[model samples]
Target: MNAALLIGLSLQLSSCSNDFLEEETYGEVKPSEMTQAANVERAIISAYSVLNGQIDGASNAFNSPDSNWSFGDVTSDDCYKGGGGTGDQNNIHQMEIFNANSTTIDIVRKWMALYEGVKRSNEAMRLLNASTDFDPALKLKRAAELRFLRGHYYFELKKIYNRIPYIDETANTVADYAKSNTIFTSEELWGKIEDDFKLAYTDLPEIQTDKGRPTKIAAKAYLVKCYVFEKKWQLAYDASTEIMSSSYGLLSDFQQVFLPENDNNKEIIFAVQHSINDGQASSYNGSIGDRLTAPGGPFYAQYGFHRPSKNLVNAFKTNSVGLPQEDNIDVLNSDKVDPRLDITVGRPGIPYKDLGVLYSTTWARDLATYGEFAPKKRIVSAKSPFYVTVWPYVNALNYYIIRYAEVILWRAEASVEINKLEEARALVNQIRQRASNSTYVKTLDGTANAGNYNISTYTLPWTNSIEATAAVHTETRLELAMEGHRFFNLVRWGEVDSVMKTYLAVEKTRRTHLTNAFFTKGKNEYFPIPQSYIDGFAPGIITQNSGY
Candidate 1:
């Protein structure tokens, strides 16, 4: 029997959920038993199905193929780059965003789905532990796979909504509540998350027959991430060093990493696997690329959602010397953009060979008029109601939750914390090298299209180097924005002020473009914990984050 098949065998044993669990199916399992191995294999696919497009439950947000629009719709620092709106003005869904109630819905959906995933994983683990049918060796491997899935899910939950109730076991009753009796403290919970990942690293095979499942390397990469989150810099550096030294170097082409054909590319440390059969196909074109690129066609238009911020589009443009244009240019013009401007955002005139045989750009006038229909960067077409109507790319490209490139960046950032600048620069340059044809350009004057004056200019660290460090950190923010790193990176750096402030300035500067949306400092940083959870658990027991 194939070892890969063995890895998925225990998923077949999931029993039907009772009426209570039924009420909250959340896509983890079906009521009927899956008796056949083929059906069981399908269940494994179903496990991946629950990995939603975005943690926010706003579909197709941040699954952008290219960074086109600013995600300013959510924060004052940014504004909607894409255009188009469903005619249903009565739809309260978009309006409810940022409200305490709306945030609660996102929290509930995320919490429920994560719990469902954990429950399914627990069932698989239990069956693998008790099964006598499979060979002992194969059973152990299967157990590792289930544990990895459970740990990954738990980690994701904890990271997104801190102080969440941790359910590691198969809870058959209310008495089985870990949060009530055996709960780990917030600090201890991080340790538990780390331990599970560590065990997953040990028991899981170094390589797997399946492309989507976690391997030892994926566990290692996540371990590094966990360590960084906890501020364990040396540990993160060590784990990252292992990944860098492993057989997990980047792919030959950076663009291929996001291509449909490159779903499980070598650069991917961990990705929520999506397939065509289970709703993945239903939401294919509504992805980030679709919204960004499909504009101007009868089939698709209303492009410019996730529109690249001048901060980010300018990020990719380099002078002839390889430095970003902002650093050296006297004044940066939006139109006198970088070559990467085409690469990162879909404009009317830019030719994207990767998208199709066509070369096109959507004019500003067209975007202002028809951008409401555009979902740019999302897989969904501009015509669909599910267009980039929400902040972030709401596409179904299966979230690359963690990639080796991020691991590299994390290491660099952590190194900076530990007073290691050269290491940080090297890592940042590694990412730049993949995006550009040449070496790391340090001088700004040589950036592609230097004549454009609208872009900003800041010198790299020549003396104090802190400015350069700040620039590198900003670069990470620009390069990875709305991909879901902006808020967290701000939190991690103790620099949420700058990000929020910068975003507000950008919004104010573009007030005519933004209309009524302006960012406020205290309110937007961390999302308030769900009022429902607080009301259910206890306002005193499970307190909300401050100022929520």
Candidate 2:
């Protein structure tokens, strides 16, 4: 499908409520009529559409906040749940403090959205299998697409709640879905997800005619991610190596990768497709989760949430030779910093965007609580011609799920795990080289150089595997800062406990809200399974995770 048609279909599918899952028929078309190829294709489109369910208004409001922003960023040390105040979105504040419970609304909402995705994908698989009208080749391709999406949904669930029910096409009824725990062991569940992605990797073409659809390379990249999560280092290394040999490459400039004009660039392996003013009355098709992250007041009329932390801002500071001064906060006032900082964050006195206005402290809603920096990567300039005022805060920017740089970084990580230090350094340098090209942020009249903007490749060779691993981890945090992967990355490295505890200790001294924050190693690693799911299941059928 073309981008325009996909946008229209996205809006149409999003309009269906949770009731759509229970309904025997879709509109006037009965389940019997769904045997036609066209209807089956629509079913497939609906499955693909569910991938955007994490966006605000795409699903129920209880889960309206994207977990990427909540669980991924705010829960980590990178961001604060910046809204009206401490009382605003207290559930999120609970998350920031490692105090969220099973009944937390965000947890319930994220669970529902991910399972809804699983259900839709399963429905597509059943429809495709029952339909006789589709060409055999097309059927195989579309089936692969459905399985890829299924694997993607399961992957999200797996990361959030380590143990979950595995439902597929055969488990069509609610009763069947309720028996989730009995069906597979946790290891078996990971194997099942891997099976789907392996099928997708084997069946999907290297490239797709549709811009948003996953390619074979995209499936391979995700498989590498899954292996990394499972700690299957050799498998991750093999899969990442295959992806590195693909046609994808880094965009020369880091800032351009997220711009509206470069939405589906070569750098992106898979992205959640978004379009503005595609006849949706609200911001359903736009990047709505990011609406609150834009500068407040005159900069852009919106709520200011997901404020970047001073710690994150400090992470950009580089020494004389362009290596990160991880512990030297005193050097921040005088040190050269990575150019990507300007691209990722909006600090005081910096150019906010293409707009001439300098980012001021007033742009932050609560300077005393959240730090001074505003998020910039996904924020569209209100002054730009591409800016859509119909939804004012939302825009036609695609949210990248996997990019080539990430693939390189994953390979680098895998290399370090397997003691391939030289290979890891080369991969990390590939990303830094591209970041080095992102030298300046443009102002209305002229461009201003980002703080120092003197990033360079690692000059010193890795002394050992552990040193190389730490370098790869730091590089991942800096390169993928606010894109919502920090907490998960730290967790996968088994560093979240130590890292977050130290982070909170120092951060409390800076931001008073974090004075009581604490991170327990085992208990805080994953979120509690939503209480509603447990209540819905038969007694003793759904066991909650360790802490909650």
Candidate 3:
């Protein structure tokens, strides 16, 4: 068979069109295709396809007020105020957290998307195991890719539902559901993910790839991140360190990282590819970027759903030069802090000179920006004249899952955990240099006011290995802000309680207009696993998460 023929077989093995398996028989190739390999490889791409739908568009994930302050919907980090309190319905970020009736459709879609990915992957594995017609080397590589994609989908599911019914090739008849065990220990599931990634790293290509496929680098990068999730710090360090030294390096200009022109730029370890021409039509993809970014152009300006918090803005604005904005400043000045602030945060009326767009005060007026003002989170827009349209969806900005900057920080953190403090300090300084525009900032060595604000000294204080592990992880919370890593990172590091008690509770109280109606953090850790899923399966084997 020709290369195209083999590639076609891979497609048949994994393509999204269910007709491939339903209407047609196995081993049958289309007019343009010939080999089983082509169809099988296509199946792998199907698995990759699901990542495009995982993100919540309007107010589900990062766009929620709880995550960002500009939306003004967050009650407390831990609790939802009400379904209609702020812009809860309109707030895409809050929708992901609260599980409202109107927004459950997207959640179901996400669940279905993941299962589709798993089904395609299983079919591919089944074909490979049964066929001797495909080339052994190519077959192994394709299989590895499928496994990686499957594990990735599972990891995403794990995060959202935390103990979703684990399914693999073992799933069979409806009656088989009773015999099947969906209750997998977290450790066991993480083990499966690690193994799949290891196989992927061994088989994937080291060089660059097309828009959607996972390169060797992407697999390795995610492996490090997952390792961090599993508390495998030393291994995470080793994996991230390799990527740091590889061809990947920080882009000289940070702004380019998000530009449409730089969608598949070298610094990106892995990102869900979206095309301007023929992109995924799912709500998660098209037009969301333009909607959030346009501020007030034609596409529609819903209050920039994802706004920066005062705390986050202040954190990024620390003196970049390590020197006070003036002389021996008692408190940190936001005026002369990290330069990335403007790039990350969008304040109303703040014009971004590079992008040639000004933040409009328009989205604030639109109730469509988030959900019904909810007791849980508030959805506030900047107030724009334009109305939110449900047509011709097209999101321009690339949603990055991992980047060179994160990999660098991951390396720096691992270095410290291994007692390589000097190495850790050097990596941390690299980030500071970019953030500060080339100033030597103080190390976290408990030194007295080494940089800008002499008001307080910053040093990591953790008694045990676990606590120290958490502190380094906290750096990730600050460093990787709004890229959708906060809540999950908190859960993984077992620091959710601290974030709730110390940060969320105080932040909520500080912002409340009515002192009597307050939010708390007691019973809001994991979201209620979609009730529908539990009801469907026999014996109702799928149990809800704790405190749901």
lDDT winner: 2
Rank all candidate structures by their TM-score, best first, as comma-separated numbers: 2, 1, 3
Q: Each prediction's Cα lDDT score?
A: 0.50, 0.77, 0.50
lDDT (tens digit, per residue) of candidate 3 on 1-548: 13222111223221212122112323364733423666655544555544544322233322221122211123224222222235444333344333233225544545555555566566567666656678988777777777777877777766655666665655444443332235568888888878878888899888633565667888999899788777687998888867877887776665545655566687887765544333233333332322333233323433333333444544543444332232212223335544444455444444433333444444333323221111101111223111124443334344566788888878766776787765665675565555544222332343522233322112443335454444355445444655656666666656666654555444444434222332234434444455555564424566666655
Q: Return the clash pairs for model 2, or none.
A: none
Off by over 4 Å in 2: 1-12, 15-28, 54-67, 328-333, 390-392, 442-450
Strongest candidate by TM-score: 2
Kindly list the per-residue Cα lDDT of model 1 for residues 64-107, writing each as its tens digit: 12121221222322223344432211121132123333244434
- The TM-score that candidate 1 achieves is 0.72
Question: Per-residue lDDT for 194 in model 3?
Answer: 81
Alpha-carbon runs more than 4 Å astray in model 1: 1-46, 53-104, 178-184, 277-304, 315-321, 325-339, 353-398, 438-465, 511-523, 534-541
Instruction: Report the Cα lDDT for residue 56, model 3.
Output: 28
